[model samples]
Target: MEAVSYSGLRKNLKHYLQQVNDDATTLLVTNRDNDDTAVVMSKRDYDSMTETLRIMSNPTLIDKIRRGKTQIAKGKTKQHELIEPDD
Candidate 1:
């Protein structure tokens, strides 16, 4: 793992990309507000993170619609639905 300033990353974008392509290398981007840092890793690691995120994201929309219908059938929902404003 290597830590570089934000300016360094911007200046050596190609070099940083090359390191990112190396599976063993990880980069830390620094010099942002509140001392926050961002990590850059190989595509394999990025894909693994994406898959984990997909698994973690919930099916909230389907659950909400099912609950709404059940509530309506039970007379627990309000009769009036709010209309959205048109742009």
Candidate 2:
């Protein structure tokens, strides 16, 4: 993550956008008024984070994931088809 003042963001919008696009680095914009802050990131990173947050927000799904991980670690997983295809 990189921090830059709002004024700096306006002054160098192109350079900052390019860096964010090319390196997937998050940019934090700070402002003196009302202690406001904003974030800039690539669409891919933003989508991935949103999806992760969505998953984490579901208690049942999270528990299932944890249980699956533990089962894999314990070699308790069985080979099975996750989906069925019909002719």
Candidate 3:
């Protein structure tokens, strides 16, 4: 995460935006008043976060994931060969 003042962000908006996108990082923009503070992040990161949140909100899916993990820990998993598609 990187922090920059409002004026500083405005001065180097392009640079800061590029850094955030390339690094997949969040940027904290601070203003004179705390109420105006904001966070900037790449769209990809934002979408991934939302997807994770959505999955976490489902109880059944979480239970299934936990069961799968438990099975792996118990060495009850099976390995399957990958299937290739015909051209």
Candidate 4:
């Protein structure tokens, strides 16, 4: 993690981005008006985070997770429930 003022980021945006890509570094920008701002990885990280959120949002997955908990409570299933295909 690194801290830089807003002006510093604006002045050396390219350099900061280089650091981000090369080292997976984070820059925290601070200002009097805005407490903190972040500059992070590019679309790769954005797409990955988006996909993760999508998968987590699936209702079927949510149901399976809840059912898994129930099965565990009742000692009715092992590590893998292997929920068969609905079809």
Q: Which candidate is the best by lDDT?
A: 3
Q: Write the per-residue lDDT of candidate 1 for residues 1-87, one digit (tens) a residue.
A: 788998999999998988788655889899768457788888888888887677557577567767889998998966678899999
49, model 2: CA deviation in Å? 1.4
Candidate 4 structure quality by residue, lDDT tens digits, 1-72: 788888988999899888877776667777766746655675666687888798789989888888989998
Pairs with steric clashes in candidate 4: none
Off by over 4 Å in 3: none
> Global CA lDDT of candidate 1, please?
0.82
Candidate 2: segments with Cα more than 4 A from true spot: 78-87
Count clashes in each candidate, considering only residues at least 3 apart in sequence or on different chains.
Answer: 0, 0, 0, 0
Where does candidate 4 stray beyond 4 Å? 61-87
Which clashing pairs does model 3 show?
none
- Can you give the TM-score per candidate against the true fold? 0.49, 0.74, 0.90, 0.56
Residue 73 Cα positional deviation in candidate 4, in Å, after optimal superposition: 19
Order of quality (TM-score): 3, 2, 4, 1
Model 2 per-residue lDDT tens digits across residues 1-87: 899999999999999999998998999999997568999998999999999999999999999999999999999988987787887
60, model 3: CA deviation in Å?
0.7
lDDT of 3 by residue, 1-87 (tens): 789999999999999999999999999999999999999999999999999999999999999999999999999999999999998
Candidate 4: C-alpha RMSD to true structure equals 6.6
What overall lDDT goes with each candidate model?
0.82, 0.94, 0.97, 0.79
When summed lDDT is taken over every stretch of 10 residues in candidate 4, the lowest stretch is: 35-44
What C-alpha RMSD separates each model from the true structure? 12.1, 3.4, 1.2, 6.6
Looking at model 1, how many pairs of residues clash? 0
